[model samples]
Target chain A: MSAAERSLRGRAAIVGVAESSLGEVGPGISSLDLIGQATVRALADAGLSKSDVDGLFTHSAFFAQPVLTTAEYLGIRPRFADGTATGGSSFVGHLWHAAAAIEAGLCEVALIVYGSTQRSHGGGLVASGAALTRSWETPYAPRIPASAYALAAARHMREFGTTREQLAEVAVAARQWAKLNPAAFVQDDMTVDDVLSSRMVSSPLTVRDCCLVTDGGGAVIVTSAERARNLPRPPAYILGAGEATWHMNISQMPDLTTTAAQESGRRAYEIAGFGPQDIDVVELYDAFTINPILFLEDLGFCAKGEGGAFVSDGAIAPGGSLPVNTNGGGLSYCHPGMYGILLVIEAVRQLRGEAGDRQVARHSLALAHGNGGTLSSQVTAILGDESTL
Target chain B: MTDNVRADVESLSPETAPGTVFDRYAAEGVLAYQSCGDCRQAVFPPRVLCPSCGSDDLGWEPSAGRGTVYSATVIAPRGKEPYTVALIDLDEGFRMMSIVTAGDDGAVAIDDPVTVSFRLAGDEPPLPVFAVEADR
Candidate 1:
């Protein structure tokens, strides 16, 4: 493909990626403090200084002006800033925006960061039942997040004959991966029966099926491919990026069995000139167990309604056909509200051959997919080694 | 129904644009949805402009009060009685979220037929909850 055709392919790369703290960071630490720490660490990993950053991107429900607040706290005046808030997938969307900005010569170095104290201060991921429109649904006291996702899980089962065991397999697979990750919140073995017997937060979903509510933050530094060569770490070149949103609330989703990942993944694959088979590893957001199953189907990894079978028999487990959520994912790893940033960080690590024990042998081409809201927003990013680029 | 069914409803303020009209219809024990006068399509949550045709001509119409359960989930908070929440696909081509009360057993399931029922929510209007159809 021509450079003008695939504008972002190999044009911009992730030079550095790091996290502030994996699990608990205490209640005393504010979100801004975590952002600052992660920013400093990521820049240092890239062998760059704070003065080299000219663009900033971040999103937070706790902050009114996320980008502005982060820039001010870091003592740097960014020439370009974006505070796009579409739930967890906001940071993945930022990667594409940053690449576009660099392609347009708007900025040379872009820093995307995220931080949250949800576990310590915000009651640990419980749904408050606060509705945006006070629609007819609010009076019934619906448990948010869980209830919202359960609706989709129920529909998927009804339409595809998906079994509860298939959904439980996703959780088990993530825990198995978490065993290798010392920073994971839950690093123990989990069986399908263990997941099934866990306390039911929402029907078809147990407490084990949900992501952890912990205090954590991460940052990714993006710059032009030419500039990335001089950085300390090997760059994970951007091969493709795309984002889309279907609905904000679960009630308004056109279809409960599907998500916007289909559109977003298609656009991303087109830009990369590669298909699902070309991907060697995947780092998909796992706020809920059903999310990865749904993404696998929607992203064209398997036929529609076959997600249940696709994940069965250790398909997504380590050493399986597809190694997904190798860093334990949000299910067993740290999920501080918006987990989109971690997905990209893990992908960059795998592409750079620095994923430690969770590393896959063929980690040249990787896909980092994220889901925001109740499957409302979707973003897909393709990261690859220089050879693939 | 048992006394401990835990189907308590809460009322919301009707000062907002969307709530003013939706609340008025709920108070009358009618399940109403917005219909675009231009494209003759149905819109949920009641908006002034049609989302499909982008026309400002929107009107309200009483729904048939019947739908099938698209999906269902039971919320079981610790130390609290579990309640069922569901997504209902209306016959008129609109989907909504609501509580499904299938008696004390609470046996609502996907694809089950359901009909609208009303329960008074404080001083505000009566809210809609789906009851599993006897035939299902």
Candidate 2:
């Protein structure tokens, strides 16, 4: 079954989406606490209780565990449980799997959840000295994520004449959107000077270009289109979803500047029987400033080697030709470790016109894309109006 | 103080380090990569097996430490000095990221010749540094 022929379009809809307190909640809160809160909230939004859910999916890397942990915490006994861990893309992949499970009659409803103590507890993205591979990267000490990313940035600059200012522009645009989002972390008035003056975490990448570590959780409830008609909000129909991995090591990649999102996004569009032009808005996962630039190209928004410039001229800003990452993004919004889940939540909100100040007018279709690993793995999902169902 | 001496002096020691692949290279001075017999492909970041072939039949191979800069970035500090970092496309086909030295003549161009060196920082192993490969 090639993705282009999948008929899952509009078979399922996202009825509910919720999030626990983003940023630092408190010292006493556990990762599980955030997960439980978001799940309960999502179920309540769907007007369903624990007893109504028969399926569940969560990131294996995240401790959604004890099986009984989330089920007991939410007071439900689900017949289906999925702990698919493909890094950051876990949530988007779960949506597809949940849809299949429901369509296959394995369960009536599925809850996909994610949570992390990345900020309050810290040590989330920090390099561990114990990993055996550290020995190789430790000598030159170029193994830190920023330095590693610089290697790719250097390649992009050499290959396409991408400039530091071009990369800085992405940070500036994200900050502009962040200023509009009440939930964003680094909402201070940021300028190109602020980005250039920022301490270098890696060459071509500044600490300012990086995302904030946060403690947060987001969850969504999925069910048949028939059930979605009765939910609190209009359902955001699942048009299509797809995921893939290119390479694990940054050095082994055929091209550091390009991402697997190209293939993932292509497959997703084909599955939904839509094209890139059909997308009215986007919620691209931007863990780092360069991520979305690479994503913009991979998703076919512009030709390759034009990512750095395509973002220029305020094309992605609120009033630009294409409004992206409206709820601030992983770059500006709270990035709680595996932030891919939040993209789905945000996309659904925008499509439903629920985003107060960040909403894009008449958002008929939205693309939610997530990058895992060091831009090694990718997941792209296309969502549309429930009337399409 | 002088370009020659600074190029000789190593940076980044093991004492102030993390568990990274470079730490081993710094301490051993061996440019090692993951080689899969199954796929005849050599990889970096020291994977357990070949991601291409999914075979655990993999071994660490020492590189000759020879390559060319696939790309480079020369940074002019906002209020500080300038430095360069590069992606060296190794002879083994894998790429190694390191600070480019040996030339203060502006930026290193793509395909520029480079060889591996080490920088000693604190108690940590000497960090991997690259110098222009005159022969290339």
Candidate 3:
């Protein structure tokens, strides 16, 4: 990429971020409605109008054509409409694509949005249905998503000497952060023991270890750095971004403990001209407790097989050295099916010093990592304030 | 199953989707996997092309039904019976998802040796499962 020379580094910045009605939205609200709500709010936050959006990026678990549906519902036709999706973290990948589009003069003022009603629908994981690809494992009826994540956690413990207590530490840290967030849905005080005794949905992963099933939608407004700086609010520049996926399903993953985050984070850091040491706040997709642990290692925050130690002793807690998932994260915050875009919202808020009580002291450099599928798709984005620009 | 050996069987492509072929063989008490002709790489849920080398040339071979549990988890679905699910690292190098009959919930652990067996419990075709067994 460096050889190619032309880079998207600091070429684009996130001007605005907003979330729609979070938690359960009940029967009247649909996924598209949430997108409309969030998009309108984000545009206002950017001090821009709906017509300013010439580019659109969105992905949905239930929609056949996300971009088309969102564009039609929002009544804003865009020259660049992308529905290219892998999974939840699809929006984080959109940041990189939007930056490239801006640099190529393809489109300006790109909108990345996502919404889900999985919680109001069933309030639990959508059960795995019978399929050809899943034929190998569906017979046993492993309560997918959770069971797949448990497989990785179990393998990590076996290979790295990671204990259940360590995995619990990840959940505890997220809850502690959630307590400080007024908008966070779950604010109840939680401990490592509470996570351990929360009824094992899967052998190692208790029900509490899984992310919250809620209905929510989020939107991020991205434009060239020149346009972003003039906005009403301070800009959270897209310093660098990268996306990677190694497998489509958990069974096909080459290694259970490690994820594609290693490659994604490396590329992101390389393009950003920095590493984890320079980051102040970290917002990672925590669909499961083990996720942050695996991502911390793969994302270069700590050594491989040392994620357990890195997250232990309240290392990622609010007052800890490295603040991660400050907005509660998917573990305690609203999951809303794909919680990737929501992560960027938190990072941008931290960069803009709008996180309120949950704000970390250093608001300059931030890292937001999103994981999709069963820890399959990983997208890393390094964001910073005007100081870094 | 034993009762529907000659019953209606739908046609399916082994490369695009290998469920039918694997089920047919599982019904007859055999566990088969594909080996890439070019890379000699073991392929599971049989694919047409070699995932390792992109060569469409592949061959089918029966597994010894022997493997080690790469990872295992006991899924307790509320009131339902708990069972150990695992990813089995076959001797041939391919890994697959299956169940281990550990007799009790949470009995199976990672690195346990297991062998595949067939079970026909639902209206669908027979599927391969595993039971703890000693193997080198």
Give model 1's docking category.
Answer: medium
What DockQ does every candidate get? 0.64, 0.25, 0.75
Give the poorly placed runs of model 2, Cα more than 4 Å off.
A3-5, A60-72, A123-139, B1-63, B71-86, B97-110, B117-129
Superposition error at A281 for model 3 (Å): 0.7
User: What DockQ does candidate 1 have relative to the true complex?
Assistant: 0.64
Candidate 3 per-residue C-alpha lDDT over B1-136 given as tens digits, one digit per residue, 9 for 90 to 100:
3222221113234423455556667777988787776788998866556779887766667788898999999887777788888999998889999889874343787888888888787787777889987434
- Looking at candidate 3 chain A, the ten consecutive residues that score lowest on lDDT are A126-135
Listed for each candidate, the true contacts retained, as a fraction, are: 0.90, 0.39, 0.92
Q: Candidate 3: give the clashing pairs.
A: none
Worst 10 residues of 2 chain A by lDDT: A126-135
lDDT by residue (tens digit), candidate 2, A134-183: 43333444534555566677778878988888887788888888888888
Candidate with best DockQ? 3
lDDT of each: 0.86, 0.76, 0.86
Residues B41-82, candidate 1, lDDT per residue (tens digit)?
898977666778887566677888999988999997788888
Model 1 spans with C-alpha error above 4 angstroms: A1-5, A126-136, B1-16, B103-106
* Tens-place lDDT digits, model 1, residues A281-371: 9999899989999999999999999999999999999989999999999999889888999989989988888888998999889999988
